[model samples]
Target: MLSFVVRRVVAAFGTLLLSSVLVFLAVQSLPGDVATQVLGKDATPTAVAALRDKLHLDQPAWERYLEWVKGALHGDFGTSLVNAKPVGGEVGQYLGNSALIAVVTVLFAVTGSLVLGIIAGLYRDRWPDHLISTVSLIGMSVPEFVVATVLVLLFSIAVPVLPAVVLYGPDASVGQLLPAVWLPAASLAIVMAAYIVRMARTSVIDVMAGEYVTTARLKGLSTWRVVTRHALPGALLPTLHVIALNVAWLVGGVAVVENVFNYPGIGKLMLSSVQNRDLPVIQAIALISAVVYVCCNLAADLGAMALNPKLRTRGGRTR
Candidate 1:
């Protein structure tokens, strides 16, 4: 178990380190020049050259990547070329807002998915399963922007209960932001719940079909006890990894949802930075997203190992 954990941790760290390289290369490959975007197209070549030189954009890609990595290791993501502000400071503020929404989204999604999934699995081929499967399908098929639009129309326009877009500044308190976060969180939750629900339902069915569950049932154990004790523990392992992926996605992949609702999250910020060619901010967001993905996956693996003794015994290898 210790060796397995050590290996996973080392792999996670290597994944993050490699992700930083990809992020740097990706940011460097974006169309349009950072200096050109900052100084405007009317700016002369000489002016752009000076700005590039000042920002070290004139340096070789390898040299710049090394410097950026060094600064990142020191918690300095460099200054934003467009805003002329510390990338870390600006990203930190937006990250807090994103985390708030992501937390709410996960709470809603995980709770709802677990309940609905279990019900659907237990009642497979029945009305409950049909209804849930239909809803899940719609959620999976519909895009986040479409979901956000429908939500805005239903709640904001038709009902007028929740705010359509976030009205507060980036520094808004949670209290001030709560009412506004619902629409965005719901949009994300709906999308995430789809994947989680399907995975959970499948896992539950598989677990229930296993021989151990049959043995427990044959022992005359109550259906509820058999499921709760023998089935649920194993069922959750697969769903957990799915949940982790969604959680990681919520960190930086909700650009459309955030944009539709004008939410001040990492996603929206990353998009804005992309448009303005703010490489520092873009790269920072990329690195953060990658870190979240790797960490979530690692946590999920650990959780699975905890839930399944066989995994630890096998040293996390599948036969």
Candidate 2:
């Protein structure tokens, strides 16, 4: 297990390195000059040229990339082109806000989906199953922005129970934080819960039909015990994969939801960076997001292997 974990960690690092290069190249290829964009349209060619020189934009692309790579190795993501603030520092602030929202969203999504999915799977052709399936389909069909708007309208504008938008302050308390983040988190959770429910339902169904489930049932185990211990454990492998993939998705896909709710998160930061043509911030956020995606997937693989003895044996043989 130790060797397996070490191997995965090494591979994850390599994947992150390659992903960072790709992200850098992709951001660089976008239209417009960062220096000119920052300076303004009225800036003269000579002024733009001087600004580029100061920003090292006049250097060869390969040289610029090398410099950025070296700085990144030392935990310096360079300075934001627009604000001149450290990109790492800016990202840290946004990441904290985003992480809080993402954690709450995942918690709600996982809990709600698992309960509904298990009920639906157990009841298969019954009324509860149909009700859950219908709800899941509706949740899946609607876009997150639409959901966010509806939530804001119902809970914020009409009822005025929760605040219409998230407000961050230096002195914000934990009690105030919940109301601030709840709307956006709920919007994200609703969308993600549908996918989780569908995946869990299918996995549960597959596991319930397996021979081991029947053996457990025949051994005089209660239906609940048989389902939870014998079937649910086997079903969780696929659900775990879905959860891991969604964690990465939530980080990047929260842009629309964040924008709607006016929540401060990395997604919103990335969107603003694109609009402002802030290349450093854009590149840094994209690289961090890509690394997060790769690491989440690696962690999921390791976790699944750890949970399933069969996978551990397979991994050993492959190694």
Candidate 3:
């Protein structure tokens, strides 16, 4: 198990390194001049040139990438081109905001999806199964933007219970941010829930039909005991990976939902950085996102190994 974890971590770092190259190149290719953005439209070519020179934008991309990588290895992500703030500090602050919303979305989405899926699976062809399956299908079909809009309408306009968009500043405390977090979280949850529910339902069905579960039922075990003791544990293994994938997906979803709701998060910051051609900040966010993605999958793999004893052995095939 330790060797397996070590190998996965090593591979994850390799993934991060490769992703950093892609992120840097992608952001570098985005059309916009940070110097021009900093100086404004009225700035002369000479002024822009001087600013670019001062910012070392005239250097070769390879030189810049090497320098950035060197600094990143030591926890220095460089400064934001637009604001001259440390990319690490800026990202740390807003990353928390984004994480809060994503965490809230995932918690509720996972809980509700598991319950609905399990119930649906147990009921099989019954009305409960049909209703949940239908809702999940609709959810899977709808886009995140559509879901966000409907949530805004239902929660913000029709009910006027929650704020339409976050009004708090970027530096607001978590307590201050909570009231505004719900709408976006709900929007993301509604969209993310479908995949998890579908996966969970399938896993449950498969587990229920497995030898042990069938034997347990034949032994005259109560339905609750059969499900909870014999089926749920097995069912959860596949669903765990599905949940991890959804969590990784939250990064992209948060990007969209944050913009729609005007929430101050790393996603909103990244978009703004792109518009302003703030390469350092953009690269930093992208790297952080890649890290999050890699870590999610790694953690999922470890968790699966821990849950299933077979996966702990040397010959166990990794899923």
Candidate 4:
């Protein structure tokens, strides 16, 4: 287990490094110049040159990338062009907010998916299965932004049950935060639950078809016992992969949803940075997001291996 974990950790670090290179290259290759965006259109050529020199943009691309990589390793993500504040500091605040929402969304999604999926699988070909499948399909079909808009229209505009925007305004309290955050969280949860439900349902069905499940049933185990005890554990291994992928997607892919709802998250922050051509902020957020994705995938792989004796034995044989 220790060797497995170490290998996964090393792989995750390599993934993060490669992601940083890709993000840096992509940001550098963007059409507009960061210096131009930092300075207004009215700025003279000499002024733009000065700004570029100051930002080290006048240097070769490889040199700039090396400096940025060094700074990033030292936890210095550079200063934001727009705000002149440390990019890491600004990203940290938004990351905290985004992490909270992501955690809550994942919790709701996993729980809801597991419950619905178990029922659907246990009653395969029955009404419960049909209903769950239909609901999951609908949830997956509709985009999160559309869901956020509908939620805002129904809950905020019409009924006034929750606030349309989630960012805490001046003088906002904990009481005020709940109603504000509820819609965005719900929007994310709804989209995530769809994937989870489908994955869980498929896993459960596959597990149920295995000989061990039949043996458990033949041993006179109760239906629930056979499903939950014998099947659920095996079923969960596959579901872990889906959950990990969704968690990573939620980390960065929440941009549209965050923008629609005006929620302050890492995704929305990245969007704003891109619009303004804020390279430091954009690169920092991208690197952080990539780290999150790689780590989540590693965790999922480890979890799946841990839960399956067959996988553990296979690893041992390979070793």
Candidate 5:
């Protein structure tokens, strides 16, 4: 188990290193000049050259990458060329707001998915199963933006219950944030739940058909106990992997949902930076997203190993 965890951590670090290289190269390849975006297009070549020199855009690619990596190791992501602000400080604020929304969405999604999935699996081929299946399909079919738009129209425009745009102040309380957060969170939750429900339902149904489940049932265990204890534990392992992937998506890929609701988040910030050709902010957010993805995947693998000891190995191979 110790060796397994060590291997996974090392691999995760390697993945992050590779991801940073790729993200840097990809961002550098984007059309348009950073200096031009920072200063207007009307700015003369001399002014653009001076700005590029100041921001180190004049440096060689290899030299700049090395400097950036060195600074990143020291928690210095460099200053934003456009805003002239510390990249770390600005990204930190955006990350906090994004995390708040993502966490709430995940909580709602996982809980709802688990319940709906278990019910659908237990009542396989019944109306309950059919209903859940249909809902899951619909959830998967609709795009998040459409869902966000409809939500705004129904709740914000028609009913006027929830706030249309998310504009949370620094001093805002949880209750104050909820109305602003609901539409975005719900948009994410609905889409995420589709995958979870399908995975959970399939896992539970398969587990119920296993010989161990039959033995438990034959031993006079009650229905709920047999399902909850004997089945749910095994069923949840696969569901957990799906949940981890969705968590990663929530972190980095909620751009459309966030934009639709005008929610201040890392995704929206990254998009804005892309448009403004702000390399520091864009690179910082990309690196953060990659790190989050690698870390979440590592956590998922660890959780799976803990839940199923049979997957652990004394040697290089699982027993």
Candidate 6:
């Protein structure tokens, strides 16, 4: 188990390094000059050139990349091209905001999906199963923007209960964030729930059909007992993997939802960076998201191994 974990961590680090390089290259290729963005449209050629030189934009790409890489190794992501603020500090702040929203969404989505999927699977081909399947399909079919808009219209405009847009202050508390957080979180949750529900339902159905499960039922165990004791444990393993992937996906997927609700998150920061051609901020955010994704997947793999004894062995196979 230790060796497996070590190998996974090592591979995740390698993937993060490669992704950082790709993110840097991709951000570097984006159109527009950061110097021009910094100076403004009316800035003279000489002024822009001098500003570029000051920002070291005049250096070769490889040289700049190496410097940035070196700084990153020391926990510095370099300074933002537009604001001259530390990228690491800025990203850290935004990451917290993004993580809060994503975590809330995941908790709600995962819990609801698990219950719904289990009930649906247990009552397969029945009304409960049909209802869950239909709802999940509808949830999956809608885009986040549409869902966000509907939520805002229903809850904000018509009901006047929650705020439509997220407002962030210097010292925003959880109470202050709730109105802003709920809509985007709900928007993300609705979509994410669909995936979790489907995976959970399938896993439950597969587990319930196993010989061991049949034997347990033949022993005259109560329905709930059979599910909770004999079936749920194994059924949950596949859902754990799906949940991990969704958590990673939330890092990127929240961008559109954030935009819809005017939320202040890494997603919004990345969008603004693109609009302003802020290469440093863009690259930093992309790399951070990549790291989050890689780490989440690593955690998922580890969790699966921990839950299933067969997966812990060196020669055993795991689905």
Candidate number of the best lDDT: 1
TM-score of each: 0.96, 0.94, 0.93, 0.93, 0.95, 0.93
How many pairs of residues collide in each model? Answer: 0, 0, 0, 0, 0, 0
A best-first ranking of the candidates according to their lDDT comes to 1, 3, 5, 6, 2, 4
Best by TM-score: 1
Over 226-265, each residue of candidate 4 has an lDDT whose tens digit, in order, gives: 8778898899998998999998889756888778877777
Please state every model's RMSD to the true fold in angstroms: 1.5, 2.1, 2.0, 2.1, 1.8, 2.0
Q: Write the per-residue lDDT of candidate 2 for residues 1-319, one digit (tens) a residue.
A: 6667778888899998888778878988888777778999999999899988987987898898999988887878888877888998888888877888888998999899999998989889899999999999999999999999999899988999988777774234556666678988999999899988999899889999999999988899999899878888778889888988888889767888888877778888889888988888888888888888887889788778866776666444443
- For candidate 6, give the lDDT of residue 306: 75
What C-alpha lDDT values do all the predictions have? 0.90, 0.85, 0.88, 0.84, 0.87, 0.86
Model 2 gets an lDDT of 0.85
Task: Compute the lDDT of residue 93 as modeled in candidate 3.
Answer: 93
Winner on TM-score between 2 and 5 is 5
- Model 3 earns a TM-score of 0.93
| Predicted candidate 6 versus true structure: per-residue lDDT over 1-319, tens digit per residue | 6777788888998998888788878877767887787779999999999978876877898898888888888879878877789988888787788878988898899899999999999999999999999999999999888999999999999999989987774246667777689889999999999989999999999999999999998999988998998899899989988988888889778999888888878888889888877777888888788888898888888888877888777733544
**Candidate 2 lDDT for residue 199:** 91
State the lDDT of candidate 3 residue by residue for 134-203, as single tens digits. 9999999998988999999998899999998888878989998999999999988988899989988999
- Backbone clash pairs for candidate 3 read none
Residue 206 Cα positional deviation in candidate 4, in Å, after optimal superposition: 1.2
**TM-score quality measure for candidate 5:** 0.95
